[model samples]
Target: MAIPQLKDKQVLITGAASGIGRAAALAFARQGAHIIASDLRLEPLQSLQQEVQALGVNCLLQAVDVSDEAAMAAFAAWVHEQVGAPDVLFNNAGIAYLGKFLDSGLEQWQRVLNVNLMGVVHGCYHFIPLMLAAGGPRQVVNVSSTASYAPSPSMASYAASKFAVAGFCDVLRMELAGTRIGVTDVCPGVINTAITASGAAPSMQGEQLQRLQAYYRKEGCLPEVVANDVVQAVITGKTLVLTGPYSRLLYHLKRLSRRLLFKITLGTAAKVGYL
Candidate 1:
């Protein structure tokens, strides 16, 4: 398929308050696309709206909790009323959990699964039907993580959620193959974002936490880089996109030897004080 032109297209992005979502909203807006940016926080969404509109393109900001089925449904309705349907839907809202699965509890699992996994499910369930009805050609981008392939020992729930996202996108992509809508599973490695800081549990305050944060800061790629890649992938109708070099490497490593990869990942997590 030929690359789709984004000019004047409607793009919907969740978790647009920060990180890759924020970067994507700006990137698409710069390409002359109308942006519907949604996030959990109103203040940040408002700030994002200003930045997006500054690009001289239309931007609609909504405070949405993507984990809520009812809220997502309402958001879909609102989008239908305001912009009809998005030419591109980016289901990017997610949370991170950074601790051993044993140290975590049921609440952590529920929260992580709800936001990181079910959030994508809700977005697709509510938005795809609308997109199909409004579409000639459109796209859906589901944000997974490098953890989808190479999960750190300390981040069990997070890894599980991302794995589910990747699997779900795989199925969705096959189902939508004959249609004009394309599904992309985006697996991003560490990107400089507040997710780590926000996910830091109360019990995790100390030198170990600082070290982990430093590692991400020193090695993580910029969110804008991922955003640019996502835009290009959408134009080319890519089915899977690994954002950072590390993410791509991890994917290949796991494929080569799952057992050896697991040991290596566990060892590295322990050395980094993540386990």
Candidate 2:
């Protein structure tokens, strides 16, 4: 797929207040994308707007919780009214939950699913149609994680949520192929985002956290790095993307050695004193 030129492209990003979202917002702005940056955190979104404006790209801020379909719908409507539908939508707001499957309460599980999976779903429901109607240079980028395929036993909920996002992106891409819209699913490995600090609960335990711990060092790729990868993916018509070598390795192993993966997961868990 040829890389799409981004000069003056209209882009909207959820979770743009910080971490990968904020980083990508800045990168896109520098490359000349008019940005609509949103987050639940008002101050950080304001900060993001300032930085993006400094890059000489138009930037707007909104305080939005992506899980709220009504809020997302209204947001889409506002963007249409104010600046027109976005050429690119980054459905990037997400959460991390690592806990035993049986132990996970409905509330906790639902919350994780809401943000990580339904957030993407809601964004598409409201935004994609408008992008189709508005037309041209339109794309959607969904940030998934390696855990979607390399499902960690303890982080079952988070893994499930991401899997849904990946699944949706894959199907949605095909569905929109004849239209003016494109979709990219990003499976980033351990990005140095506050997601570990803010999204994952301290109580997460078991074999899953062990595997994640093995992969996530304090020195993972910076949020900025994943952000750059995202922009590249959006520009290209890349359907599936892994942000790092580890993510690619994990995704392949899961495809090639699913049963062995089961045994190795338990064995590795036992070695780590997690099983």
Candidate 3:
């Protein structure tokens, strides 16, 4: 069911060129929401804009790196000038790092955290004030990962970044308690997306990367599945959304017993040859 309130609303989404962001853009467009899409790549953003415009909703495209605080601030200023405060802000830009803690370098960790954790911070810092000043109902969606709850062996940096994102959203939610604004932390399990292909895994060889991508393609859910959940989260003001296969189960398992969940995660990763 479409949310009637979403019609003519403005939505800003980062990492909108592909994967979950692209799917979410189309999903929101289907709901009659205009899109403000940003990505580091202009060509894909243009392609996404074309498809979004075909959905009969306007799409404004920008090439901005979410990891850059100054760039995000400038983009936020531009957005305010163009459409005031957006009704929805989706901080969905992130990168993946797949390597054991000892194998990964400090630079790799920094890069991952810059994009995954600090990116969310920049988005909330620059945009939330706009939403508050506008003084109406609004939603902020931060894309964390199931890794936040169920950590895997070779994804130390990725898990750390997502954990931070989840924690940040929790506190942000509390701080915005009395306002009309709502914060939702979206935790997605493996989904068939380019993230695996684009991720930095220094210890993995080309063949291993190919195998990982194949595994995701064969076992992961579609990005549209998560996209639908994101829209629903916004409509219902859900505080947390766990989507994709095993995401909710793992979340519950972690809550039930952290030690058992850790064991299960290690066994699963080994069985899949990810460790």
Best model per lDDT: 3
**Candidate 2 structure quality by residue, lDDT tens digits, 1-275:** 22378888888999998788999999898889999999887887887788889989899888999999999999999999989888889999987765566766667788988899999999999998898888666888998888778765657778889888889988998898888788888898767666754444445554555545565554367888888888887788777878854688777778898998777767754553233
In model 1, pairs of residues that clash are none
Q: Stretches of candidate 1 above 4 Å error?
A: 1-3, 201-203
In candidate 3, stretches whose alpha carbon ends up further than 4 angstroms from where it belongs are: 1-4
Q: Write the per-residue lDDT of candidate 3 for residues 68-124, one digit (tens) a residue.
A: 999999999999999999899999999887766787678888899999999999999
- lDDT tens digits by residue: candidate 1, 175-240: 988888889899998898888875755556688788888878888889999999899998888888
Task: Look at candidate 3 and tell me the lDDT of residue 275.
Answer: 77
lDDT of 3 at 37: 98
Note the clash tally of each candidate.
Answer: 0, 1, 0
TM-score of 3: 0.96
Q: By lDDT, is 1 or 2 better?
A: 1
Order the candidate numbers by lDDT, best to worst: 3, 1, 2
Q: What TM-score goes with each of the models?
A: 0.96, 0.89, 0.96
